[model samples]
Target: MTQLHYDVVIIGAGAAGMVCAIQAGYRGLNVLLLDHAPKPGAKIRISGGGKCNFTNRRVEPKHFICANPHFVKSALARYQPEAFIEWVERHNIAYEERDNGQLFTLEGAGQIVAMLRTELDWAGVELQLNCDVVAVIKQHETWSISTSQGQLTSAKLVVATGGLSYPKLRASDFGMKLAKQYGLEVIPSRPGLVPLQMPARQRAWWSDLSGLSLEVAVTAQRGPRFEGAMLITHQGLSGPCILQVSNYWQPGEPISLNLLPDVKNVAEWLLDLKQNAQSLSGALKQHWPKRLVQAWQTKFEFDDHLANYTQLRLDQLGTSLTAWSIYPDDTAGYAKAEVSLGGVSTDEVSSKTFETHKVSGLYFIGEVLDVTGHLGGFNFQWAWASAHACAQDL
Candidate 1:
C-alpha cells in the first residue's frame, strides 16, 4: 500500500476539474487531478460535435437554473466569457463565433483539451488518469481518498466529478453521493438540454416526419421560450429550439410550437393569399417542405385551397398553426442530455468560493453543483467560472 499527500485533490478531470487544478497549481498549491477515464476532457473533446463550444459572448445569472439563483452570480461576474476568450487567444487556439454568440474551435475540440493540458503541465499540476476513487474519508483536518491506484490525502478535496449525463464518458453521481454522505442537501437531478420523446401516437406521427427541420418558436408550459430551428426526430422533437426549452420543461407539461412564427396574423395572411387565388398547400409549400405540408395536411383536415375555407374556419386554422401544442412523454434521458439539471444544492455551498457550508475544505463545482445553463456555450462558461472561483479560494 502506498500513500500520497497533496495540498488539493480534485476528483474529476473534466472542464471544471482541469481549470481548477491549473489555477490552484498556479497559486503554488500542490494539486493532484484524478479521473477514472484514461483521458481528460472527454466531454470537451466530443462537445459541439468535436469543435467544442467553449463559451458564450453573453452570459448572465438569468441564463442559469439553480436551486439558489444567486449562487452563480459571483463566479460568473469575476471570470467572464471575455476572460476565457482572452485565455484561449493567449494559447493561440483559433476559434470562431457561431450562431447565438457561441465560440467554437476552428480546428477541433482536441486543441482546447491540449491547451488545458499544457496549462496544467506548466502549472506543475500532477494528473492521474484511470484512477477510480473507491472511498473518501475525512478525519479531522485531513481528507483521505482511496483510489484504484493508491491511498491519497489532501488538505482540501474539490469534487468536480460532474453529474450523470454521458455515462459512456465515465460520468457518475459520485459528487452528489459524497455531498449526501457529508449531510449536505442535494437537489433532484434530471436530464437538461436533451431531446424530448413523444407519446406512442405522436411518436408514430413524428417518425414519419423524421429528418424534417424548420425554424420556429418553442415554449414550455410555465417555462421559458426559445426561437430557433426545430427538428422532427424518430423519437420526437429536437434541434436548438427544442433543446433550449427542454431545460425548463417538466414531466406532464405541454410544449407549444409556433410553426409560423414569421407570420404575425395567420388569418390575414391566409385571407390575402385567398384573394390572390393561392392554394393553402401552395402557400404552405413556399415556407415548409413539400413532404411536411403533405403530412401536416393529412393530420389536420384543412382545405387545400384558401378560397374553400370560410373566415371562421381560417381563423381556427390560423390558431392551430400558430400554437401547435404537444405533450412530451419524456426526455431522451442522461444518455442524450448535454448536461444534468440539478445536483448538490447551491444553498449548501458558498457562492463565492464553492466551499461546502457543512464540510470544510470541501468544494463542489460545475454541473454537479445544481447550476445548469441554457443550451449553447453557457454550460461551459459556468464550468470555467465556477472552477475559477473555487481555485481562487483554494
Candidate 2:
C-alpha cells in the first residue's frame, strides 16, 4: 500500500474541503484532500439548475438559520461576498447576479469546480477522490486516517464531508459522525430547501395543478415570509418560495400563502368583476387560473352567486382566496433538499477557525456544521467562509 503523509488531512473534496486545502497549502502546510466521490464537487455541478449560484451577493448572518444564530457571523464577515467575487474575477469566471442578489456563473457551474481545481493546482494541494475513509485515530501530536487509498498521518484533520442533502451526490453525515467520534456535540440534522409532500388525498389536486406557477408570498406558521414563484407538483409544492420557506419549516406545521400578493383587496377585485355581469368562477378566473377558480367554486358551491352571498360571506371568501392555508404530508426529505439544516453543533466548534473547541487541531465546516441557510445560495457562502476561516488558523 502507498503511504502518504501531510501536515493536514481534509476529509472532503467539496467546496469547503477544496477551499481549506488551498488555504493550508498557501500557509506552507502539506494538505491532503480526500473524498469518496469520483469527480468531486458533484453537488456544485448540479446546483442552481446547472448554473451554480455560488453565493448570495447580499449575505448576512441572519440569512442563515441555526440553533445558535450568532455562530456564523465571524466567518461570514471575515470572508465577505466581495472577497469571493474578487476571486471569481481573478479566475475570469463570467458571473451575473439574478433576482434577490443571487450570483451565478453564465458559463455553467462546472466552471466553479474547474476554477477550484485550478486554484488547488497553484496551491500544490493533493486531491484524492474515490477514497472512502474507514477510520481515524488521534495519535498524540498527529492524527492517523485509514482509508481505501492508504493510511495518512497529519497534525490537523478537517472534516468537510458536508451534510446529507442529495444521496446521489454522495452527500453524507460523515462530518458530524466524525465530530462525535472526537467527543464533540452534534445537533440533530434535518432536510432543508426541499419541497413539502402533500397529503395522500391531495395527490389528484396536486397533479391537476402541476405546472401552475404563481408569484406569491409563502409563509409557515411563526416563520419567515418568502415571496417568489411557487409551483404545484405531484408531491406538493416546489419552487423558489416553497424551497425558501421549507428551510424554516418544521414537522406538523401549517403553511400560509398570500395568493394575490400584489392585489390589496381581493374582495373588491372580485366584487368589481362580479358587477361586470361575470360569473363567480369567471370573475375569479380573471385573477387566477381557470382550474384554481373551478376548485374554489367547488369548495364554495353552497353560496353560488355573488348577489346571493352576504357581505360577511364575500369577505370570508376573499380571505380564503388571499390567505390560503396548507398543511403538508411531510417533506421530500434529504434526497431532494438543497441543504441539510442541522449537523455538528456550532457550540463544539470555534466560530473563527471552525476548529473544535475541545480538540486542538480538528475542525468542522460547511454543511457539516449546524449553520444552514435559506434557498438563495447562502449555503455555498458558508462553505467558502468556514473553509477560509479554518485555513487561516491552520
Candidate 3:
C-alpha cells in the first residue's frame, strides 16, 4: 500500500472539511482533505431547493442546541455571520434574504461550492475524493489513517464527517464511530428539522388534506413554540412551523396547533356569529382554504351554521379551533431530516479550538458535534463558525 504523510488530514470533504483544509493550507501547513463521495458538497447542492441557505443575517449562541450551551459561543463570536457574508460578497456570489434573516444564493448552491473549491485551490490544499476511510489509529505523536486509497499519517486529524442525516448524500456514522474508538464520548443522535408522522386514523384525514398549507402557531407540550407556515403532507405534517417544533418534540408528546392564529377573542367572535346565525364554514374560509375548511369540518363533524351551537358549545368550539391538540406517531426519520440533532458530546471538545479534550491534535467540528442549530440557515452558519475555530487552532 502506498504511504503518505501530511501536517493535517481532514476526513469528509463537505462544508467543514473543505473550509478547514483551506485555512490550514493558508497557514502554510500541508493539508489533505478526503471524502468517500464522488463530488464535494452534495448536501450543499440540494440545500434550499438548490439555492443553499448559507447563513443567517442574525445569529446568536441561543440559536444552537448543545449539551454544553456555552460551548459554541467562543467559535461563533470569533467568526460572525458578517465575516461569511463578506466572503460571499468578495466572491461575487449573488444572494438574497428570505424571511427570518435567511440568506440564500440567488443563482444556485453550486456557486458556494465553486467558491470553496477556488479557495482550496488558492491555498494549495490537496483534495482526494472517493476515498473511504477504513481505520484510524493514533500513536504517541502521529495519527495513522487507513483508507481505500492507501495508508497515510498526519500530525493532526480533523473529523468533519458531519452526522447521519441524508443517506443518499453518503452520510454515515463514521465520525461518531471514530470518536468512540478514541475513547471520546458521543451524545445520542436523532433526526432534527424533519417532518412529523401522524397516527393511522389522523393520517387518513390529513392525507386527504395533503398539499394544503397555512400559517399556524405550533406549541409542544415540552414548552417550545414557533409560528410559521405548516404543510399538510400525505404522511402527516411538515413545513417550517412543524419542523421547528419537532426539534423539541418527543414520542407520545402532545402538540397544540392554533388553527385560528389570526383570530383574537375567538370566543366572542364565535358568540357574535352564533347570535347572528352565520355559517361557521364561512368564517373559517376567511383564514383557511375552502378545501381545508371542508375537510376539517368533516373530520371534526362540526355543524355548518353557528345557530346549531349553544353559548357553551360556542366557547368549546372556539377553544378547539384555537388549540387543536395532536400526538405525532413519529418523525419522518433521518431520511427526511435536514440536520442531525446530536453527535460528539460538546463536553469533550474545546469551545475555542474544537480540539478534543481527551486527544491531542484531534479535532471535531460541524454537525458531527453536539451543536445543532434552529431551522433556516443557522446550521450552515454553525458549520462555518466551527470550521473556522478548528482551522485557526490547526
Highest TM-score: which candidate? 1
**Taking the tens digit of each residue's C-alpha lDDT, what string does model 2 give over 1-394?**
2336788889989988998899889888888898999997899999999999999889988789888889989999999888888989999999998999999999999999998999998998888889999999887888988998877798889999998889888888788778888788888888898998899997887778888887888888766788889888888899989998998777888788887787887778777755765567665555577777676577656344677667787788777777778889788998898888878888888898887889888989888888888777898999999999999998
**TM-score, per-candidate, Cα-based:** 0.97, 0.95, 0.96
RMSD, every candidate, angstroms: 1.4, 1.9, 1.6
What are the runs in model 1 whose C-alpha is more than 4 Å off? 1-3
Task: Count clashing residue pairs per candidate.
Answer: 0, 0, 0
* Arranged by TM-score, best first: 1, 3, 2
The digit string of per-residue lDDT tens for model 1 on 89-204 reads: 99999999988799999999999999999999999999999998999999999999999999989999999999899899999999999999999989889999999999987778
RMSD of 2: 1.9
RMSD of candidate 3 to the truth, in angstroms, is 1.6
- Candidate ranking under lDDT, highest first, comes to 1, 3, 2
Between candidates 1 and 2, name the one with more favorable lDDT.
1
TM-score, cand. 3: 0.96
Q: Candidate 3: which stretches are off by over 4 Å?
A: 1-3
Candidate 1's displacement at residue 91, Å, is 1.4
